[model samples]
Target: MLHLGKPLVVAIDGPSGSGKSSVSREVARRLGLAYLDTGAMYRALTWHCVSHRIALDDAVAVEAASRALDLELSLSPDQEYVRVAGQDVTDDIREPAISSAVSAVATTLGARTQLVRRQQETIVRAGRRIVVEGRDITTVVAPAAEVRLLLTASEEARMARRGIQLGGSQSQEQLAVQVLHRDAKDSTVVEFQRAADGVLTVDSSHMDFEQTVMAVVHAVLDAVGGHRKNG
Candidate 1:
């Protein structure tokens, strides 16, 4: 799938806390390609709806908000950000409030369709050579990508990593709801926990961060025959 004299596109799908975002960013940096965090796009929309007092269950209103959302995401690995309505919301979208409500916005088929259209546009605008990572990237967003991978970890590992990131602020029960329950809800919309046909799986259950990064890097290199400093 290597295009002659063009950048390579990499698509990664995984459950939450599977390290797909970090690994995809690192791989894009090493490959000198742009990195697109599709999940952040959803989070930004969720934030907008909540801030505007739009009820997520109102599918029509949510879809309208999605259509009107002035969202922009930077694909640069070193300078990633999300902007909405000319406001910088790079960090706000990661707040716990947004995390808890994002699925409500995401599971709406109308909202998901709007976001998926925008995502495809972003990929095309990148000349089809950016590394895009999210829940459904490999299966729905970029199935034709040069390199497609599903990064996964055991539930225990996922919960542990998320717990460390949350800094023990949430109890185990809360963490389970955030990790497992959220995955269960989101899975109803898109298949993420399993590898799709032609997509490689990278299990990082026992691997450290650096190891996971290398695993993805190797997968991309093996699929597209690209050379990198670390490779």
Candidate 2:
């Protein structure tokens, strides 16, 4: 087992379909750390707004909704659930409707601010030993984390993986919109496609799930080793 003496915050940023969520969850499970899917937070907020008939374009209303959102999400990798105001919306947030509209909420500066603050609080609540994965987790949410990584993949690979994830229901065009177009819109707000300073990049274009997980695990260990040497 890999354990850092102090709190460990592993922040991972990645584009859509890069497997950040699954890989981060598995990494946390293996390391016995808390797991946080920050993207799901955004998705939950999006679902909340949509369910209430709030206009996505109305930034003010959206921000207000974000502030008032009563969200409960699973912190354990062994369990997965997301609730909004005590209502289970774990699977609803993953719906295509929420995916298509989440960027609007994510790009809203005010809403993002609120959610980022909530995420930071969650980190502190988790004893600061957690694996957090999202679009701007490394840059914005946990910039001072012990381990920061940007997981990326080729567009072709990402599209294929997303298609598989959606169970082949979405057409190629739909996948393009969800994977490529969504990334393009979200990029306007955060630079997740590239790695920031001191952030390692893992191109999982050719690696399988296990390979990618091992690569991230190795990166964590390497970072720990470097920290020991510097200390």
Candidate 3:
């Protein structure tokens, strides 16, 4: 599971608001590896579509934009940026306007492929250790990854976390409805992946953020130990 010289590649996947970002960041920090947030890639593309007024339902136009994208994802202790071509559009992608339409753009097969291909390319370049986190990393982008984890939470908890992030001081009554709607759509994705297997799963519905991060970090370290013994 964990190999020392080969680089400890950790893949963390799950639904939205499941603390994937925080967990992945902490795991990468503790392990001293780079962290990749694949969700931000989707959000960056979604931001592009909105900025250009591309029709969310028009796959052709969306694919064209995706194909032409020169996006960059950078994560540091102090800054995270999703760069579109040359512009840093991290903050732009998180606005409420982009959030409403992101699922539509993200769920499209063409859009996902466009982003996933780039993500896999980044893995090839990491060379050493890396922690990649996103909804599809386990099932798609990093299927051969040594350490895979899926973190999930109840719909109620998910919505509450998202609402707090949305405004800092806010309520989930509105976000919860949207979260449920997202779940309904994402169910189809799970069904579509019926043939997938071998992903370690975690239900963080009742877990605090620190607990969630520790769980994932421990999993990665355990895997590294096994990787060492195997060698």
> Mind giving the per-residue lDDT tens digits that candidate 1 earns over 1-231?
344558578999999889878888998887778899999999999999999999999999999999999998898999977999999999899888898999999999999999999999999998887999999988889888888999999999999999988888988888887789899999999999999889899999999998898888888877777664563
Candidate 2 clashes between residue pairs 3 or more apart in a chain or in different chains:
none
Candidate number that wins on TM-score, 1 or 2: 2
TM per model? 0.95, 0.96, 0.88
lDDT by residue for model 3 over 52-155, one digit each (tens)? Answer: 89998999899889999888878552357788879988888877677667778777888788888988888877863788987778778888888888788887
Off by over 4 Å in 1: 1-5, 227-231
Span of 10 residues, lowest total lDDT, candidate 2:
222-231
In candidate 2, what are the lDDT values of residues 1-231, reduced to their tens digit? 355557899999999999999999999998888999999999999999998999999999999999999999999999999999999999999999898899999999999999999999999999999999999999999999999999999999999999999999999998998899999999999999999999999999999999899889889989877322221
Backbone clash count, each prediction separately: 0, 0, 2
- lDDT score, candidate 2, position 14: 96
Better of 2 and 3 by TM-score: 2
RMSD of each: 2.0, 3.1, 3.7
lDDT: the better of candidates 2 and 3: 2
Among these predicted structures, which one has the highest TM-score?
Answer: 2
Best by lDDT: 2
